[model samples]
Target: MAQLIDSLRADGICIIVVTHDMDLVKALDARLVYLIPDRPGAGKVSGGPVQSPDGPDGSRPVLLPVAAMDQRDEPPRRSSRSAYIASINPAFRLIGAFLTALPLLISLDWVSATVALVLELFLLMAAGFTPLRIVRSAWPIFLGAPGSALAIILYGKAGGATYWQWGMIHVTQRSLDLALATALRILAIGIPAIITVLGIDATDLADAFSQVLHLPERFVYGGLAGLRLFSVLRDDWSALSASRRSRGLGDENRFKAFFPQAFALLVLSIRRSTTLATAMEARGFGGTEERTHARVSDVGPRDYVYLLICLAVPVAALATAALTGRISYFGN
Candidate 1:
């Protein structure tokens, strides 16, 4: 339907829709017109209401908030998106993300972690990201860093100028320093890892695994098919929840409902998996015949350059900390 409308619009045909499907309305960017009803006391009924080309629905369309009137007021959605990062081979992207995080994992020093974070921020910007976009993808890591830091601040190695103490909790200078380093390290390792892996296609990754890395196809394709079913299972879960609610079973405590809901979902999932396996077997998934991939997977110069940059970030960070005599090994 959308394609038909687009083709018609391309040939200068006016596309007018009179349905109440808000999804379709927004999808086609259709203008809405309604017959204005007469009020109780203020006014009399008028002739057929003619909608003006621009002000047909007035400044704001009187509709539900979900059916937005003006598009301009809505903010662009924040996303961890980077064409450059996604263009790299999936295998190499994962390898590079691992390498980028490896060095910071070795030492617990604020200087190195801070330097790594700063350098990674610059790289993240080069990958076409803003602060908000990174945060959008990594808010869990952001929240988790402070939580870990709080733990370290309270109960970590407590020496060198004590500040506060309460039973097992001890606040000290060393503890504070360690907490800061831990937080910085978590951020330095997490943000780039999350962003780089944001847009990797599952099929592309499976292709890379099978074609480039030569992993077992049975496992690789099985994982890929399982990943594809995630959305289907999610929809099934929603439907189950609605069914339960309509049957008056969802009014119970969530904890009490969780077991039965989970059991039903599990049963449905197993049935779907059985059907999927049967279909795949019919299509020769686990057969003896050799298989081919639709997309080619290989690395190039750009991937090498990306890997080098990933290596350089931690190298520079650790070097700075080492030169400044602040680099501290784990558990030392």
Candidate 2:
């Protein structure tokens, strides 16, 4: 991401990173951009960067000043809202679990997971993401859940009365129960995963994964390289789609044309990945035996709390059901 940003900026592209992390914003540039709210349009958004002096270490973190909309161009209020949220701190694992499963979560019936997922969504919204942005970020889970749900239903082999059979396929009372359980479990698992990930930034994720997992540096750096290419490929795919639309090719039946286009995208991605891997190898990225973390990634107190909650919920739910004599695993 740094490389990409640097490259873009070097080419005079207007790159703006709206971020809460002082460390990251400092890394990006000394000059900062501020978005101030309009008054009559109060909370109506307007923004621009006014460069301030750098930090003491000659890093010279430039502060951007904004003026009030109504005042005689008096420098706008520098609210501490952003600082407070950023200062609260977050746990790495909580971020990871959330990112990994959030999409599948949002796809699940909200009634079951609403209490948990809604809280996560609230946190993410407070972190400055819109609902649509959060949903889009989690969109991939929509594709992943059906395959998983299908696998559970097909293979779970519910031990009960058979209702229908075709070849080896069976629709038994047991199977139905298994399917429902499987679907619910998937939803429960997915929601928090999505929320955590969507809330955490990409750099934070990379740091957590590398530091917590103790992943091989080669694999980590190589994967990061590949990820950079993947992002480029995503952009390229969008451009290609727009081009296709301009060429009047967007009206084609989705299933038929989508596959070919998707295949083309896969090929493009693979090609980019190949190039990236080769470049990394040439740069001796895999040569290092010992590695050090550039940034701290700790599983803090909050992560443990979140994990405990994750473990406790189903346990409490199951116990309640058992006490009520409704805890039959088979629902017989």
List the RMSD of every prediction in angstroms. 17.5, 14.8
For each candidate, what TM-score against the reference? Answer: 0.67, 0.42
RMSD of 2: 14.8
Top lDDT: which candidate number? 1
- Please count the clashing residue pairs in each candidate, in the order shown: 0, 16
| lDDT (10s digit) by residue, model 1, range 1-332 | 87899789889999876664566665665456553323422122235343233323435343222222222233322223776786788888888899999878999999999999999998888778898888898899999999999999999999899999999999999999999999999999999898888777788789888877889887888789989888787789899999999998988999999889999999998998888788778667779887755456768899999999999999999999999999999989
Off by over 4 Å in 1: 1-80, 234-261
lDDT of prediction 1: 0.82
Angstrom error at residue 90, model 2: 8.5
Using TM-score as the measure, the top candidate is 1
